[model samples]
Each structure stands twice: as structure tokens, then as C-alpha cells.
Target: MRISELKKKGLESLKGKWGKAVSLMLLLFLINVILPYIVEVIGSGGFVQWFDQEGTPLWSDIFGTVLSIVLIPLTIATTWFYLDLVRKGNPEITEVFAIYKDGKTSLKLIGGSILQAIFIFLWSLLLIIPGIIKSIAYSQLFFLLRDHPQYTILEAITESRKRMNGLKWKYFLMNLSFIGWGFLCLFTVGIGLLWLIPYIGTTLAAFYDELIVLQEDEQPIEG
Candidate 1:
């Protein structure tokens, strides 16, 4: 599907659902941003003290790394929630934590996220462009894992790479299409992000749906 169609589908799916979408975004911010900032402040005695202490920066980095790793499942679950919303139009708010309900799935998501990050980082060492390209190539890994629970981390990664082939530029452009909305969000002092994020997430889910259809059509016939 074209980017315009995907975006239209996303907007249609979000109709009558903006409140819930914005609420979910706020909850995510509480968990991913506010909670971390609070923890860092407490750890350093206060926000101002974070910069005053000599070794606090190192500890802050360590804490940030560990927190990000722990949050991998939540991150993927958020994606799944958006996918569900795009496809079904009424995903439960609890769906944002679905990965945690399955221990094995949570582990797979965490491991896959770590490995994906490492691969991207290694590619980044070569140059910024390759890293960006590879990141886009692996962009579908989490969605693939959500759809194919039986897939191993490496299998999902490999398949995402294959599926993204010849479509990286299109995907990149699809994301770039959001730049205008992103800039508009700046005028709201980031408050507009609650709406913009869900807009982007649902559009991405539509993109994935389109890719799946393309994949099915590309399959060779079995005579």
C-alpha cells in the first residue's frame, strides 16, 4: 500500500479512539521517562546533585542501560498493542503489557532486542549511513517476533532483513512523512507528542500489514 493509504487507514482506525491512544502514550511516558528520571534523582540525592557528584554520571549511565534492557519487553508489547489497534480497532490497554504475561516470549523479546542493538551498533562503527540502513532493515524484527512466536531471535532478524529488501527507501520515506507533524509537536512544547506518537505507531502497523500482504502475493505457486 502507498504511504497515503496507510496513513488514512491509521487515521480511520484512530477515530473515536484518540482518548485511549493519548492515555496509553501518557502511561508509557510515566513508565519510560518519568519513572527513570525519578529514580535517577533519588539515586543522586536530587536532580541538581546528579551533576555535582563526581561518580554519579557513570552510575547514571549504568542505571540507564539496565533500565533500557529491562524495558525491552514493554517496548515490544507497546508495538503489539498498536498493531492490535490498527488491525482490530479496539486493543485493550492491558495489551501493552502482554509480553510480560508469557515468560518465554518476554525472554525472547529481551534477547532479540539486545542482539539487534549490538548488530546495529557494530554496523554504526563502519559509518553512520550503513548503521541507518541496517536499522531500517531490522525494523520489522519485533513485529515478526510478535506474529511468529516460534521464530528464534536470529530467525526473526534474518527474516526481517529479507522482508525489508528493496523496501528500505519506501519505509524511510514513510517515516519521513511524519517530520511535519513532528515539527508541529514542538509548538506544543512536546505535549502534542501523545497524539503524534499513536499516529505514527498505528501508521507503522498499517505498513506492516501491507508488507504481509505483499509477502503473501510474492510467494511462488506450488504446482
Candidate 2:
């Protein structure tokens, strides 16, 4: 589907669902923003020094790893929640925290994230363009992981690459359409992101839904 169509339908999906969406957004703040900010404050303000004379580097790595683990699944969970919101029109705000309830799934998410990061970094070492392309190629990893939880991380990564073949540029444009909204969020001093994040999430989910349907349609007819 085209970018305009995705935006129109995505807005329609979110029209009466702002409350739930914003709630999900706030949960995201706890996951993505507040936790890291608190970590940084503690590290920079000598809070960790009471325990150790030299803790800054250790604290940095600790928080960095913690945030990576938290962020990877939280991101997938956000997309999963929004995908549900698109498909069924509603999902519980607690859905965002569902990852914590399943330890195995959370581990797999962490593993997948580390693998993707390593691959992207290695590719980036070769050239910027290849890194960008690989990043987009793996863009569907989280969605597929959520939808097909039975799939291994490698399976999801492979399938995402296959599914995104020839469509990454279109997907990139769909994301580009949100640049204006993102900048507007900056003007509001990041408060606007409480709204814009979910807006983009729902729209991206809708776009994924469209891709699913398109893929199904292109499949060979059964006798």
C-alpha cells in the first residue's frame, strides 16, 4: 500500500483509541526514557561512588546492557500491542509489559537483538549503505517474532529478510512520512512523543498488516 493510504487507515484505526494508545506510550516512556535518565543521573552524580571508587565505566556498561535487553522486547511488545490494536481495535495497556511475564521469550528477544546489532555493525564496517540496507532488511524481525513466536530468532531474521525483499524502500518512505510529526514532537519538548510514538506505532502496524495481505494474495493458488 501507498504511504497516504497507510496514514489514512492508521489514523482511522486510532481515531477513538487515543486513550489506550497514549497509555501504551507512557509505558514506553518508563521503558525507554525514565529508566535510562535515572541511570545516567545516578552514574554522573556519584550515586554509584559510595560503593566503589571507580564505577562509572562499570555503571555505563550495566545500564547499557540493561537498556538493550529491556528495549529490544519492549519495542517488539509495543509493535505487537499496536498490531493487536489494529487487528482487534483494542488491547490492554498491560500488554506492553507482557514480555516480563515470559522469561524464555524475553531471552530470545535479547538474543535476537544482540545478533541483529552485531550483524548491522559488521555490515556498517564495510559501508554505510550496506548497513542501512541490512537494518531495513531485518526491520520485520520483531513483528514476525511476535506473530510467529514458535520461530527461532534466526528463522525470524531470515523470514524478515525474505518478506522485505524489494519493499524496504517503500517501507522507508512510509516511515519518512512521519518525519514532520517527529520534529513537531521536538517543538513540544518531547511531550508530543507521548502522542506521536503511538501514532507511528499504529501506522507501522497497519503497514505490516497490508504487507501480510499482499503477500498472501501473491501466493500460488491451491488446487
Candidate No. with top TM-score? 1
Cα lDDT for residue 161, model 2? 81
For candidate 1, what is the lDDT?
0.84
Q: Can you give the TM-score per candidate against the true fold?
A: 0.89, 0.84
User: Model 2 off-target regions past 4 Å?
Assistant: 39-57, 216-223
Report the C-alpha lDDT of model 1 over 105-177, residue by residue, as the tens digit: 8888888988999999999999999999999999998998877777778888888887898889989999999
lDDT of 2 by residue, 1-223 (tens): 6788877777788878889888778877786767775677676765555355444467767877777776777777778888887786577777777778998898898899889889899999999999999999988788877777878888878878878888899888888888998888889999998888887887888888888536634432221
TM-score of candidate 1 versus the correct structure, residues matched by position: 0.89
Query: RMSD to native for every prediction?
Result: 3.3, 4.2
Candidate 1, residue 61: Cα displacement in angstroms equals 3.4
In model 1, the Cα lDDT at residue 163 comes to 83
